[model samples]
Target: MDEPRRNLVRWLLGGGLSASLISFLYPAFKFMNPPDVPEASVNEVSAGKVQDLKPNTGKIVKFGSLPVLLVRTTETEWRAFSAVCTHLNCTVQYKESSHQMWCACHNGLYNLNGQVVSGPPPHPLEAYSVHIRGDEVVISRRA
Candidate 1:
């Protein structure tokens, strides 16, 4: 080919290779150094009304950016805990059949008080404070 045509071919090939290389490296670069994102600073959250949750049942409530497990153990009793498992940060759920909090991620069990009962969890779940304000149920981080 003529010199001009060869130069044009070389430019096109170089441009394509650079684009492909950038496409592959961009994601890895982003994965290695993620952008800083500020988390929501929330101290308290209203889960819902007292009547919304029935006794012997549990529900997951969002407290800021984290999940909070709200359980009504008895007709007049309430409990709130950080739903994250201490072992692997998995979301925990209330197991009514056994009257305990359970992390299915590794079969970790915790009592209603958030103490690690058994399994791979190295620490107890973080306990939160529950308050009854009129007919509403409010959950707050413990000091």
Candidate 2:
């Protein structure tokens, strides 16, 4: 009888600990999914007509859900950069005449080549590889 009583007690204690452990572990397991990087869709980006973009001006294009700045530095050359700011995750605005990328939230400034020349930005802007397909400008990760 004593053996049976001890066995019952042990079973009850083991079950309680197991349940508690599972409760703690389940949430951890649910939150353990690997981090994911946001990817821009390739199909949504097109040439976006050179005639529409004025030289020395930046036009914001809505490609999928991302905002991309299409800038024409010269009549022959077109460039593209992500609107996302390198510092504090703010969106960056292109300053055409100065060819500097400016973040209004702070005093962060970057050169036309996306280099961090001054301000609080620790890194330069992320450059999107761009190319011309006929009259269309293509912006893509593969570019």
Candidate 3:
């Protein structure tokens, strides 16, 4: 091939290689550094009815865009806390047999009061006050 034709071919190959590299690296970078999202402000949320959640059972409810885990420890006692784990933000659930919150992602454990019990969680789950109004379960952040 002529000198000009050879130069054109080299340029095209280099451009394609660079584009391929960028395409692969871009997603890896994004996966490592996820974009930040503004959290929605929520003061109170109605979880459900007291009669529906039996003692020693739990349910996940929506508080804005976040998941709130509500547990009924006794017939007269209910607890609510943020379901997101503090370490990696994994969703947590209540383990009825153990009577604790458990994060399946990392085996993080938390008590009914949201205090970290074991595993990789660095902070306790955010606690919410539970109020029973006429048969409805209401959860709200502490003042």
Candidate 4:
């Protein structure tokens, strides 16, 4: 083969191999350390209607990626708290019988106001202010 022709083929092969490696590695690197997705700024969350939650009952509402527990302590009183367990990041639920938030994963207890009552929880659940807009229940982060 001519010298020029040999050099051209070598250059093309190297370029092709480099492109192939980059194509395979780019996705792997992305998967390992994925880019951060911009979170939607959520100042408040609508839990549900007043009738949807009976007295002394609890419901879970999505506040961004995490869950928020909404509890109706009385006929007119409503409360909201972060549903993620402080101990292990487990989702918590409202136990009507216990009348408080309970994390079944580690037996963590949080009061209606989000204070840690017992178990392995290190801190209290994040509390959100509750407001009643007619029939709808509104929950917002405290100032």
Candidate 5:
């Protein structure tokens, strides 16, 4: 076409290409480098039965607004994880004998250590720290 028309077409094409590139790159960048891991409040989470929480059993404990999973291993060690599922952030339930943590919302299953064994979980459940304080079992964030 004429010089004026050709110049206008070239400018439009370049602008469109740049916009497309930025649109694709923006999300990729966000996904690659996540915003940040939020700071979890540090407090003692008391769960029932440091004694009744028998081996291979788990219970849900709360510290302020946070929900944590407390599990008793076969070796009598107390382990803790964030009760929030890694996939959709749903709460998880505990099976005492099988030692498997079950998320009924999507049928997601995790081992006592919070490792996903089945269903659509994207990552292993986050493990925290637990200890015995006074007569209560305390679950807390690891430093």
Candidate 6:
């Protein structure tokens, strides 16, 4: 074709190819090195009213972005622990039949004090301090 027309077509093709390459590489680069996001500093969180959980039962509460497990072992006794399993970061639940925290992902077991009891868990669940203020149950990180 004409010389000017050929140059125009070449520029258009080069621009399109660069745009496609950038579109593909941008996401891959982002996925490989994600932005650094600091975790929210949470000192204490109000779980709920004491009456919300019955004796021998457990409830999961959100502490910042993490899940905190609150177990009412008895009418006057309470315990709080991290709900994440140490094995693979799986969420853990209370098993009333066994009176312990159980991670179904690998059958990891933890006692009332958040101590690893059995299974493949490499470390004990983090324990939190439980405070009873009037009718409210508050959970806080230990110093």
Query: Which model scores highest in lDDT?
Result: 6
- Per TM-score, the best of the predicted structures is 6
lDDT of 2 by residue, 76-124 (tens): 8877777877788788887876787788888788888888888898887
Which candidate model has the greater TM-score, 3 or 6? 6
TM-score of each: 0.77, 0.71, 0.72, 0.77, 0.63, 0.78
Candidate 2 residues lying further than 4 Å off, grouped into runs, are 1-18, 24-44
Q: What is the lDDT of candidate 4?
A: 0.90
Instruction: Report the lDDT tens digits of candidate 4 across residue range 54-94.
Output: 99988889988878888899999988888889899999999
Global lDDT scores for all candidate models: 0.95, 0.79, 0.92, 0.90, 0.81, 0.95
Q: Model 4, clash count?
A: 0
What is the number of backbone collisions in each predicted candidate, taken in the order shown? 0, 2, 0, 0, 0, 0
**Prediction RMSDs, each to the true structure:** 6.3, 4.2, 5.9, 5.4, 6.4, 5.8
Which residue pairs clash within candidate 2? 47-136, 47-137
- Pitting candidate 1 against candidate 2, the one with the higher TM-score is 1
Off by over 4 Å in 4: 1-31
Q: Would you list the clashing residue pairs of candidate 6? A: none
- Per-residue accuracy of model 3 over 1-143 as CA lDDT, tens digit each: 59999999999999999999999999999899968987878999888778899999999999889899999999998989999999899999999889999999999999988999999999999998999999899999888
List the candidate numbers ranked by lDDT, top first. Answer: 6, 1, 3, 4, 5, 2
TM-score of 5: 0.63
Better of 4 and 6 by TM-score: 6
Among residues 3 or more apart in sequence or in different chains, the pairs in candidate 1 whose N, CA or C atoms overlap within 3 Å are none
lDDT: worst 10-residue window of model 1 = 34-43
